[model samples]
Target: MGRFGKLETDVHIKASASKFHEILHKRTHRISNVSTDKVHGVDLLEGEWGEVGSIICWRYFHDGKARVTKERIEAVDKQNNSITFTVIEGDLTEKYKSFKFNIQCIPKEKGSVIHWVLEYEKLHDEIPDSHSMLQFCVEMSKDIDAHLMEGSEEPYHNDISGQKCEALSINKSKKRHVWHCLIFLGLNQNTMGRFGKLETDVHIRASASKLHEIYHERTHHISNVSTDKVHGVDLLEGKWGEVGSIICWRYFQDGKARIAKEKIEAVDKENNLITFTVIEGDLMEKYKSFKFKMQFIPKEKGSVIHWVLEYEKLHDDIPDSHTMLQLCVDVAKDIDAHLMEGSEEP
Candidate 1:
């Protein structure tokens, strides 16, 4: 009953959707090479690499301990750019009755979004949820995205004994084993720290489409809709919803007035998603970088507004963006109430 649960998260990736999906769908064997710190190896045990019914064994580290999982390819939907893996054996089965993983790469107007869903039925209510595992997937995805965008074709080498070796091309006819060790030394030097991500889900009674329309097309109206939080929003360059367009927001945070100059990074109306990257703003005083993404997921009756905040602190003393996250939730709730009132009018 209550022990059965699901956890979901969306990771914003800088890589193209098609490329990211290709790695997951066709190049899964190279995953350990791209994300060497997390995944030690991925071995094909049954069937072919991207085919359904194929079984694979994943050797990796989780929660500071080495773990293994034997998973079967459940589904591969090319049209939607998604894949599903069902765990059939290994360490995960020791505590959970069942566990499944689904990953979807949604193409945006610019960069892509990686949606991860983990479903499991625990043997007992006392068994904790798979939050750490979800986080591991997220971090691993980030590493892979970084590698894809910046890595070169230079082959890395590794040995079966777990030591670094020269990269080799497998010759199946010769019965040569494929040893994948594609490592770009220092490829991720600048990507390690200061960056942060936060997500908050706010449920509402208003239609998800209507809310999305307000934020996507009629963003200037947000100030009017939530006057207490947003004083104004002005288009500084280009057109609304256009990628690379610049805009400025006058808002209240921590009971103090503030402003932020941002550039539109992506706006996918089909998926009800938008992203904003801040270039200049008062908040930039403490943050080296800041970005925001808003996505709406529809439900049977109401819907949920997913807000993601990505930022990097200029220094260690800077606090996390909890207050900014609260501001986003407050403003979204205000707009939701406004939309509901409008729907009931006349």
Candidate 2:
């Protein structure tokens, strides 16, 4: 093979072409969760995500080796239903002088076809083409397709506008197919949707101890800081900051008021960590189980607030807890500002 060559492959997807294309470009960050086996994480390095010329870092596994790459979004053409990325640094640069990835979603009668193209120039003739990397991308596409199709309101159809959907592929058919697949895999449908663990880190100008105190000891006061999101919190059992304490929280999300009854599962003052497990309230209606862990790490200048969410959905139709993670970050930001203002007072 020549030092310069191209690798191409196509994937048949059950998801609509427009939706697949939109996800490939607009929701690139979410691919890591959808294809966790291949993609460990994606982080925005420069510019805004999903925009042309933005830079993103990818941590993935390829050929049984952990790999990392930083690529810049070179093109996003909605008219062609395609997006392109050019590798600027990281592992691939060691062997390849240049590497570029392009993905196009083509609408078809039955479903859609995802076409992946890899253009690269090897450093030397001895270096091999990156067929393995191309294969990895193909598998990731299938994972993304399955994720988009799961719990979607629209039936599988070629129309991008989503006005013309096939009635035969509606919710009933999708549910039956899912049940059949679970049966074949010897899995229980009721216990199967326990799917995601999401983590977020927010850096703030507040001290770790102060932040920890707010969540562990003075949680009821959070409504005063984040007035819009948190209406109030009441202690149901035990004392604040004590393990086994039960609390009820009234919050607003998705433009609606919601409530959650949570118990203090653990408290690690030494590490500035506290854990809460939801036992009752509105969240339980959609989730079989939900839990939250907050840890504050002290730094030279400020602190880092880390939030981890472990949740199990009642069914695949229930969305992942990305919004809840956003809520935690928002609350942290609000509290950080409140503490900074207090310190400035003479």
Candidate 3:
């Protein structure tokens, strides 16, 4: 073998992490029932299912050819929701000297993100990279994600207009989905249209970089990000803090739980800023559109946080964005205090 290759991809899912991890490791053979189009059969050939050193054979079709892949269980880390396997036989052996695959399902507040990795050594330079195999794995991951999302309480991925979106019921039959997660935090206004900014700042004893790290990398640390007022934040389609990615905010507003999906319009790490543009939600009832922008500015000790709402009035008889701004301020302060308190601890 003279060639080596590795590839990694992330698949966003709104399913329970523990549940999906179970399906991936403990009940992998059941995938045939979930998606017959991809997985034909999975047979345990040797030691035991899911245990290290156990050999398993997969009978599947890839790139329009029937293929077999025999893999040995190498490691299973439950705490991290990860599993590893080494290919021992099958069509993969025809082109590779050795192949290792690692799958990790990372849990988020509202869903899970599966990180799939493949490391392989090819037998010759003529053998192409395992692009088709990676695509096969990604499709399989999506199938499992759809199956698990079926069990969530509120399918945040659905079009939560007061009227149930028929498309949802239709997809429910096909065992697939078209929508993803969305979130929103706004107040019902009694007056006409007005623009407002929710500005809140805190002086944490911790450093600026620490404040950013706690928020940027680990947003689940912010308590108010997921709660009664805001159902949850599901990353529908991108990196956590990257621009142009989409996110769904599940919300509990006015005696009802709804979803508002938005796109990440901007991300300025150097300035500690992230902006979300609301594309669809109950807020569409009274407003043409809305944008939520949160920024953290370095202060003397910690950071000065700012939450702004730039929105347009759908009509004239709607409420303003004050209460929503206040809510934003309260949430920001809560996060600041929570972080500050954590910083003072041993």
- In terms of lDDT, the best-performing candidate is 1
Flag the better candidate by lDDT, 1 or 2. Answer: 1
Model 2: lDDT of residue 196: 51
Clashes of each: 4, 0, 8
Measured with C-alpha atoms, the lDDT of residue 86 in candidate 1 is 91
> Any residue pairs clashing in model 2, and if so which?
none
Cα lDDT tens digits, model 2, 1-346, are 2366465656666778888888778766667767889987677777886899988888789989988888889999998899999988878877777779988898877667787778777766566546568558767886887788797643232211111111121111111000000000002323433455656566678999999999999999999989999999999999998999999999988789999999999999999999999999998998888999989999998888878788878876675565676677678888988999975311
Superposition TM-score, candidate 3 onto the true structure: 0.45
lDDT of each: 0.75, 0.74, 0.63
lDDT of 2 at 313: 80
On the 0 to 100 scale, the lDDT of residue 161 in model 1 is 26
The CA-based lDDT of model 2 is what?
0.74
Ranking by lDDT: 1, 2, 3
| Poorest lDDT segment (10 consecutive residues) of candidate 1 | 176-185
